[model samples]
Target: MRRVESLDVLRGVAILGTFGTNVWIFSSPGGLAAVLGGGGVVESGLRALSNGKFLALLSILFGVGLAIQHSSALRRGARWPGWYLWRSALLLVEGVLHFVLVFEFDVLMFYAVVAVQCAFIVGRSTRVIRGWMIAAGVLHVAVVGLLTAALYGKDVVGDDAADTSRWLDQVAFRLDNALALRAEAVFVLPLGMVLFLAGARLLRAGALEQSVRGDAIRRRLMTWGLGVGVPLNALTAFAGTDWALVDRYLCAPLVAFGLLGAITTLVHRTAEGPLRRGITAVGRSALSCYIAQNVLASVLCYQWGLGVTGGPLWTVTCFLIVSALVTAGAWLWLRRFPRGPVETVWDVLYRAPQRISSRRTRCPQGRSA
Candidate 1:
């Protein structure tokens, strides 16, 4: 399938934005606890601005990709979602390795698992998909409501600190307590399905592609999205306040959608230039870049390496610098190669079986027999 620059740009923004939230976690000795504890105005502000927003963007993009793949398969006269099952399976394997070896809090495994379920609805009627989305949204809200009530006045922080002295032990511990690590996924997967369906809906409606209706849709999304999203996100920044739950469940998703609208609008308006090209490149290789960020974080922040721990400013600085380097690397790599290393590997793995099957079909009759 041909690449959509807009999706790529939005993905680039998501990748960088994810780093904004993750940097604090990566750099803190207190791990997740330090990030959630609210260091100061800067930290709180960053958390309020980012946190769930980028993740939402990434999830939405995942849905968009699935929709695009399904459409492409139909166009090629292949079975619906023709290589997607293999792709999702490979992604799950990649996600598992990443979770066990790189970051315990990785979302890829959950995404892959959810994606398998998402595939079932690919060519379903719009009404059916919409119904599913609504159901998922309601469930998400209910779950969040229950969680809010359960932890209403409590201070929720990091689950447990990793034993940084022994890296292998830390991995083993996380592996043993895998369910705990996937606790967030229980709530997240349904919400992601909603976004995935929403993406497919948009594609079906021709909202993402360039057209008159697309322009009008983008405008509405920008206006309504920001109008509702900004204030709610602002409310989420107050630490130790009663509003944290509301901010997380309600405001965060609003802010995320709003950001997506704004990003889409900007990507549409901006002229093609070096800046656009670089960001698009980053988005194109998002998986590679994301994995690289975690790898770099492990080396820089973990006790086995630099063991650097600091406040939000330090983390933010690190994030910006690393992002710049990664973007530059992607741009340079793209100049010489058609795809990122990870993307190439993904394609090769998924396509290998098809290639073998085709070769077998083409073999001489005697040899085939």
Candidate 2:
């Protein structure tokens, strides 16, 4: 399968928006509490604009990437998800390291776990895949619904937002609270599965194509997802911590679909340009940019570095500055290198096992030539 520019564009959009979503956590003195509990008006509105929507979009794109890998494996007569497991394992390791050292809200580990599950079924028949999607959807709805109902008139107010100025202490806190820190991933898994499968199906259905059918699909996604999903999300967003589950898990993904649809359509109509190319370059270097952004944000906002959590306007400004730097850095890096620095490192890691296996097969150490 050839690379899809539209998908790349969509990915670029999602990447930056994810930065938009996460910047708040890094900015506020309240940290995650600001999001989990309620912030002031500006914070709430800013959080509402970009929050779970981009994360959900990322989930769908991840699914699309996994499907592509599955297809590539079939094309080369490679075993389905045989070596993919190694890839996922590498991602898992990366995620773990990232969580321990850099950021607590890393998504790579969860994506790695879901990728393993999705890999097995990506090549299944349409009916089977659809069945899995439905099951995943039902599970997600049930879990979120129950949680939201239970939290009705309640709260998830997090602990003291100010981590000690020492970064290591923050790491220690995350380790001590590992289960609690990682619990959101457990709850978000079912929806992740659903979005993953949905992304694959959408790609196969040619939702990115410049055709009547594609347009029709995107229109529906835009109409229902944005048209209806936006209102529902806003309602929950400003309400309170009681509505966080409904806002993030349920309503936000609908807005994500709307975003995916609208952005893809924009990609279709637009021509190549510097701005477009830069975003696509960022998309190509997404993993690098993703990690880099978090690290940057941490140094800028955490108690140890700048140690200042300003108001919402300052927070938004920080987000924009960080995103612009990341974009420019990715674009500049890609100009000379085929891949981002991290991606280059990842490719090296990916190839090492294959090289070892090939040598073992060819040399046959026990047998004389």
Candidate 3:
């Protein structure tokens, strides 16, 4: 199937924003609580602008990709999503490894888990899918409200000493905290599902795909998304309140969709140039770029590598530099290869079972006919 440049562009932008949101967690010696407590304009700005928005975009894009793949399979006369399920299974494995070895607070595992469930609803009627999306959103909001009421005015930050040890120790620590990781997943899964369903709905309606009608929808998304989303996110950032449920479940998704709309519309309007090419390249190799960001952050912020810790400004600077380098690297690599290294691995894994089965079927079993 042919690639959609808009999706690539949006994915690239999502990757960049994700990096911005995660930089603090990756770089801070105080962990998430410390960063949240150490309030300032720059920190607040980053929180307001990024926070949940990028992750929401990424989740939505995952659903969009599922819809695209299902549509492509229908064109080829396939009746089921066997290949897509294989892809999701592989993604779940990768997400597990990433969480255990690299970052415990990773979202990929949750995304993978939800994506497999999403596969079941891929070709459902538009009305059914829309109803599911609405129901999911409502459930998410209700759950967030309850969580916020329970966890309000609590000191959630820990005072653990900064680990100035080997990377293996860090990995071991994450493994040891497996229960905590699971708890985190339970908390975030509902919200992720809402975004996933929303993305599938949009793709089903052909909003992400280029069309004369899509342009009008995109404009509306951009206008309303930004107009409302920006202020709510900004307020959340500036307040620095510990209303995790409200921010993550409620406000963040709005900002994320708005940013998605605005970015998609802008990409459509912008003429082709090196800038567009570079961003699209980064998007094309989004998996590789995302994993690379985690590696880079570990090296630069952790004691095993640079052992450096600073404020939000430092984190933002590191993110910008890494994004530029990653974009350029992706552009260069794409010139020679069809897909990113991680993407190539994913494709191979997803197809390997089918390939082996085909080979067995082709070979003579007992005797030549």
Candidate 4:
């Protein structure tokens, strides 16, 4: 089967782009404070872009991929909905493992849950898809408002920092944050599903596969991204200057989209040189890279490895450099092999049964199925 090079490119960009911000946490004084915006301009700008913009790009790409895979299954006369559901279930399982073992901030499981809804919309028209996307976006904004009001209302009602150092209190705090984050995931998941279905619809319409059509679509998205994404992000940065209300929701997604637009446009126009090919390679093995990065970051920041907690922006920058080297090295190593180890495992779990079934059956061409 032909590979979707663009997906790889986009995934690679998303994974690496995320590090541009995560590095701050690894290198700052309290780590969490840097991420929460107590750091300087360098760290703040990085956070503005990394936290939302890249993530949105990833979500959009996820939608596009779901559509492509579903469409491909349809062409093969396979039951796409069932297969995709199974696939998402497995991904959810993977994501859970990732969250529990590594970071609660993991998004893969939430994406899987949201993407299950996309299967139902596989055959929807573009207008329907676009409308759904807009609704999802609006719903996200609404939820943010409701949550913000709830948190502040509680504070207004005298919910103070009663005690700081109790272990039970810390555990409770972590649990509360986990619940809040999961709740936010519920809102964001639908948006991802909408984007995924939209991507599939665009694919079915041959918008991405045709050069002229793809270019036109890219241009339009780019325009929207620039006109909307850029200004919102800049405004977010300004609002975030004091870490206030407006900065929390709008800034991240807008910045993420702007960066995604810029990178996508660049890739679309590039000469596909060694750097581009390398990015494509990293993107191809994106799942592995995503997992690998956390593992590496843990080593760099956690109590285990370097133990260099809270240094400066430049230190975080070093982590990014280290991450790139590690990613490049892993990507290069995988070039000699067909599938990444993690991807191979996922394939085996998801597809090996079919391979076994094919071996036991015969085809009309006097060959194996």
Candidate 5:
């Protein structure tokens, strides 16, 4: 009902949903390679449907959140521009730390950098913003599709063949790729800003606030997201296994957005129940839970905790179970604390430091000044 609660719920879902896709990396035989369907058809299919679709959904929500933050700032008469820049910078730092120290795949820092690019446009006219969103989404898909087609034609078949040089090349290739794409800028940051703009536009148009539109739109989004996500995902599974036509990066984001909209609608429309409560609780501590899940997952799969590296599909499933439990545990812990540990630090970063005067005021000394 409340804004923060609504956002927290969505953020929580996005965080967990992201893990839903990432867990495959933790529990598969070839690690991430297996989850990418390098192992076999069934595992690959499962991973595509689970991970691809879920991550897309998470990305779209990231956009929605950007809008929420901007809108909230404007509503309170706060000078949002400067504050957002600072916040984005803070996130960038956090993201970099996450990448270098904890995980090489960290995306936040990139997103933080990307967020700066669109700082000026978020508050612009909805039509203009919408145009940019459409253009970016379409261009991105087209480019990816073209690239996939070219690779397919070049016989660049997706293979798990172990090549010593290939492994070495991957690092260099990813670095160059990251730079050319402005990896975070093109892939996530822009997409998120666009999505946030759309969400804000929708909010302004009363899409979420209006009962009539809410019901109609929610139902439609849910239907379409599931309808398309299921079949296309099936196709993706088959393509990855048989043909390699399905580009997860390209198709997944679209499917995920539809699914996210659908789910958001369902969450709001459905009576508050266990599922809602659980998700909301998790959402409340989303930041902490998000980082925690990654850490927990890493330990489970790394040469650490269970040393369950290169495990089977079943093992990955177990990792999911454990991760979910950890999320629930974190949610429970937050019941008393109100915010996750990292979230608290984020708050400190975003909020002004408190000042306690050390100088004591001597009683006016019977002061008749």
Candidate 6:
């Protein structure tokens, strides 16, 4: 399939923003333990810039890709979501491995689940799709609401953190605290469903077009998402832990839409430059870059690697340094190779089963007789 430069650029941005969020956790002395506590003034302030916005944008972009895939399938006279199930299943396996071996808070597994559910439901009647989206949105909101109220009403006491110095022991620790570590993934699934469907709908509605209609769509998103969403999100940042649910789950998504609008607009208006080209390359090799960033960051920060623990600013600096290197590396790799290393492996795995299936369905050599 042909690549969309705009989408690729967006993906690059999302990839880095996600790392921005993850760096805080990686920098903390207690990996997963940091999730339940607040950070220093500078750290918290910087965290607000990323918090939940980019992750939400990433979800929407995933939906857009799913829509594109579904379209490709239909155009080829193939069954909808036929082998797509296999694709998502592969994603789930990747996610599990990532969670256990790399980052404990991997999003791939949950995204895989949402992709499966969405593949079956997309391209249905407008009313049906809207119903699903609305239902999921409402359910997610209610759940977030209840959780927020509970947090405000009472503090959440967490267990003392265990040592996370050894790589092997860290793997064991993730396995032992599976539920606790996986809670964020589970909690975000409903929102994933909502955003995933919304993204498909947006794609169908020409959300990425560069013309008049597309401009209008983006304008509205900016008006609501930036003009309204960003402010509320900022307020929540200062509102303390109780309001974090409001900030990340609710307000952050608003800013995501706004960022999409702003970025798309900027790309269309600006001429090609090093920064744009760099991000585009990163976007093309997004999966590979994402995994590399995490693994490299772990090597730099985790006890098993460089064991570089520090305040939030230092960790954020680490994230920036890693992100820059990955972007530059991807730019260099793509110049010689069509895909990144992991992407190459992923595509091979994705198509291997299909090759076998096609071979099985082929006629024998004597078919002419």
Please, what is the whole-model Cα lDDT of each candidate in the order they appear? Answer: 0.79, 0.89, 0.79, 0.65, 0.60, 0.87
Model 3 lDDT on a 0 to 1 scale: 0.79
Model 2 clashing-pair count = 0
User: What is the Cα-based TM-score of model 4?
Assistant: 0.82
Order the candidates by lDDT, highest first: 2, 6, 1, 3, 4, 5
Residue 286 of candidate 3: its Cα lDDT?
A: 94
How high is each candidate's TM-score? 0.94, 0.96, 0.94, 0.82, 0.80, 0.96
- Over 84-182, each residue of candidate 4 has an lDDT whose tens digit, in order, gives 787888899998777656555677887888788877776567677778778877886676667666655232222222122343453454455666546
Highest lDDT scorer: 2
**What tens-digit string does per-residue lDDT give for candidate 6 at 1-369?**
465558999999999888888888788776645755776667678889998999999999999999999989989999988999988998899899999999888989989999999998897988999999989999999999998877785667476564567888878888999998888888988899888988898888887878899899999999999999988998998777778889999999989999988888888888989998888888899888888899988899877789888876688689889989999999999999999998898899999998998877775644755
- For candidate 6, what is the TM-score? 0.96
Q: List, residue by residue over 145-229, the lDDT tens digit for candidate 2.
A: 8988887886558566536489889889889888888998988888989999999999899887789999999999999898999
Candidate 2: lDDT of 146?
91
Better of 3 and 6 by lDDT: 6
Score candidate 1 by TM-score against the native: 0.94
Error of 1 at 211 (Å): 2.7
Query: Can you tell me which runs of candidate 5 are displaced by over 4 Å?
Result: 4-6, 153-193, 241-246, 310-312, 353-369
* Candidate 3 local Cα displacement, residue 367, angstroms: 6.0
* Lowest lDDT 10-residue stretch of candidate 2: 155-164
Query: Comparing candidate 2 with candidate 5, which one achieves the higher TM-score?
Result: 2
Better by TM-score, candidate 3 or 2: 2
Off by over 4 Å in 2: 161-164, 364-369
